[model samples]
Target: MTLSCFDLGERMLSVAEAQRHLAGLVGEPLAIEACPLAELSGRVLAEAVHSPIDVPQNTNAAMDGIALAWPQPVAALALVGRVLAGGRFDRPLAAGEAVTITTGAPLPKGADTVIMQEQLAFPGAGQVQVSRPETVRRGQHVRRAGEDVARGSLALAAGTRLGAAQLGLLASLGLTGARVHRRPRVAIFSSGDEVTAPGAPLSAAGIYDANRYSLRGLLQALGCRVIDLGILPDDRETIIGALRQAAQDADMVITSGGVSVGQADWIKAALAEVGELGFWRIAMRPGRPLACGWLGEGRTPFFGLPGNPVAVMVTFLQFVQPVLRRLMGQPEWQPRRLTALAAEPLASRVGRVDYLRGTYHSDREGRLWVRPTGRQGSGILTSMVLADCLIEVDADRQGVAEGEPVTLQLLNDFS
Candidate 1:
């Protein structure tokens, strides 16, 4: 696999370079805390969890039926008693004797099998008849001990993100708390005086600020505690002061509409005055002028996204989101990708990776196909709204042909 050199100062870098550097920024995860099971969703496990007991705990009936020995000594069996779930038979099964059992009821001692109720006939006089003796199989409809999970086995490994299924599994283990990393506090803001907030009266030359809102949603989806520092003007001193304070208050800081070459010079100067700039550009479309910077004496990480709405999202997905997952202590989290047949030819160029907004669906024959959203412009927010996935064209390849295999990254990997 090709890797980008992150140390190339001022030189446009590749997406991999930024990813590798940001991923390595946090040497260790944040402090571990034992959160209540109900509040464990979206938190990353700090250590592996083990099952204290066998999942089933006992050999029980998996179906409502008659529990008897594998082989019957006679044609008919005497129905001694009945057992429901959580209840057990008081005596062992005798030769030619059977007990009615409900699902999950523990089998009587000496009984090694169960015949589902549908396969049996009640001949009355306290007897259950097995008309087809050959149909009864040994151990059928029985949940053996430790069938689901063995005692003292690893149930979930460290770095596992707790979601619905994970929480349910922990609940099954009778755990009320889980050791997980604390949520990272991220400070976010938008720059540029020309950018106006939504719901506010806009000047003729001003555009609505979509980056801050969109970034907040993205960060929250990954379980981050966002600190909205509001908007910053084109002043250098104000930018530097705000960044310094944000660095001290938050684990990470992010801004949009600044750090581009020849423009946002105040942001560049502020970055230099406050701390360091890793790089200001990348060899990618939509967000070529992505900035990797650090602020203050603590060297808190910073990400300067593009001014355009679409570029902000593209850069965040490609560069920012990975770091967020890492900072949140999810070492096992990786961007989800899938391959689909391109329904139409996608134009791309070499030397820079292309991410085309596209909607994907499976055909009746189970073939997955993708078609790009109309008008692939950096300022087109509608393109992103209408697209469910991003069609990724490798930097080494020029384009994707119709019906050819195309790689795609989903917009939402987890809810």
Candidate 2:
């Protein structure tokens, strides 16, 4: 089970090294487009956006209160004018003068303090008594100009993913649209004579193709424009032709199955004939056979993944996801991992990194715990549906005991 004991008899690349190689191969961001703010959610910014005007625009009341000028021995003040939101008192306040202002109403000139309406008593029609004058501090309850955002300052930087708060801020700045990088275009397919589509008549040896659909979902979740080419026939000409077409149209071409060095595998051969290809034996369980290269004259990136259902998912999340984000101009995207206590012992090899499907939960004391979701077989697609995360055992670790801390990659919480 160790690296030296591997049957492949060659030095396999660690997950980190393989990731670095893939990262270095991806090209720059695609073209940028001016996208409307209403449709900019999940888009990556291509350029920094600056504020045209100050947020809140002017000094205003932060709460409903009586705006007044506070003197040393504050006494009774006369309510000269009433100001609600969107209404402003024109004239400046004189000594012992006060104005009733609602939340977000502009503070009148010479008004430095505001006392809550509850703290003041309207003794007469025009007279207001301040019982807690000492509680009213200078410049209290006043929102200063440029407090939230100053004019001509950077509001959002490039590569920032637009979300609810970001869009709200842009809307406040009076911007209807923003410049963003185009979404990455992806083409996916599965190759194998045994793989067939669901709802079709199946023989005893035929298995429904699940990798393409799951890959489509994963790509869509990553905001990719996925073109599903379906299952390719197990023929050299058909595989080569499909790969060429995919490379010409997509930013990244991915195929599941036919990546291993078996007699029937044609993915590596097709890649070699159509473009540059490298078959790698990565030191990772469930997903060890991987093919990485470029295709067509434009050099579209290509990835060949294993045939196992779980292997396709693991390889995509760990390898292809980062490359796609980089091509989309997203700089902050990375795999999220957290350390949690293992609820049960798990056996693993020393040379290979293991991603075990697990159900993770938080106890009443807020401690996180994880346990395996039944079988850890690569073809058990149902196990993934029952697990929330993948417990990642490092390449150097042989096994994990109960209560031992282990790093788990969160799979369900995409946001």
Candidate 3:
């Protein structure tokens, strides 16, 4: 059955709603693979990791110092012996005796504090004098075994995204490899007869296909394995065939354009013929005509984005990214938003949420200021290229005035 634009918009899910829906649909667990620590970057851990042993392995000096009992006064004491890292001191330090130890060196028997070398004055006759007050405390400047990570403790939780710090933690736990969820396989394409490949001569109405490349890069940044299906023309038959092929191999299929109610829009019909039509016409500007559904007997999900460049990008980031994160078994899969003052006035209609591309900066007072990139038209891809963030105007709000505080969604980290 054909779904009306308002009906689709009303049924259109919020970002969180879409994520939950997709998670329910894809309830099956993702396949986990054992990957070397080096290759596990950006992958989600599939199993909880426990530390086999304690970090530091033993009590060691935190700095180069004389290992001695605390409460020792500024009296000359015999320099008994020296202990370096990885060396054991079999002899116990008696009263009026001190042991020289370096940073990370194991504490000798009877030594309870580390006195920094600079705090002591060494005389010619194998003795030293400490002028500081009784400042040294027992067990000062020492790292105890298992203080960081105890054996059998949870080192990393399942579904944790393995980043640089996570990798280092795994290494410290003596883990050479990790079991991580397989990267989601996504197929991306752009539709429209007027869309031509870059570097080619443009016809009177043809424009370069930026959405395909842009979406591909976005998917890659999300750690998905992307299959580029290239650009499909506006023809219904060709679009359906390309989508069918993509659905057969991909976990999710994504395309831009030809989903609206216009006469030339054939993506809606093509999607219906191949799969169950879910929803279209989201309550969003530059992306209201977005469509989402499932394809194939297996119900592989698909996204039909608007033809306009800005619409394609905004819709993908707001909608499709979270679903991909769920498919990869990521625990927290939400974009962060921050409030910033509008640098200038922005005009908008009240029915749809508007994502205006803009540059964000911090003033001397540390207040965030956002200025929209000129030309808020959905067709203008250049605006997005120049923008660092998308200033979000709520669906019920008409517009924002200069110096008014509004929420800003970051597209990329500038710092």
Please name the candidate that would achieve the greatest lDDT relative to the true structure: 2
Query: Candidate 2, after superposition: displacement of residue 383 in Å?
Result: 2.6
| Among all candidates shown, the one with the greatest TM-score | 1
Query: What is the number of residue pairs that collide in model 2?
Result: 0
Kindly report which residue stretches of model 1 are placed more than 4 angstroms away from their true locations once superposed.
1-7
- Give a tens-digit lDDT track for model 1, residues 1-415: 0114335767767777667667766557778998999899989999999999888888999999899997887878999999899888888888989899999999999898989888888878898888787877788999998888789999998888889988988988899989999999999999988888889999999988999999998889889999998888888889989988998999889998877765655676788788777655677887888776678887787888888889999999988887777777775577789999999999999988888999999999999999999999999999999999999888888888899999999997753
lDDT of 3 by residue, 141-206 (tens): 888888999999999998787878899999998889999899889998888889899999999999
Q: What is candidate 1's TM-score against the reference? A: 0.95
Candidate 3 positional error at 132, Å: 1.9
Q: Over the stretch 155-249, how does candidate 2's per-residue lDDT look in tens digits?
A: 99998878789999999999999999998899999999999999999979999999999999998876789988999978999999999999899
Worst 10 residues of 3 by lDDT: 1-10
lDDT against true structure, model 1 = 0.85
Deviating ranges (above 4 Å) for candidate 3: 1-25, 134-137, 413-415
Clashing pairs in 2: none
lDDT of each: 0.85, 0.88, 0.81
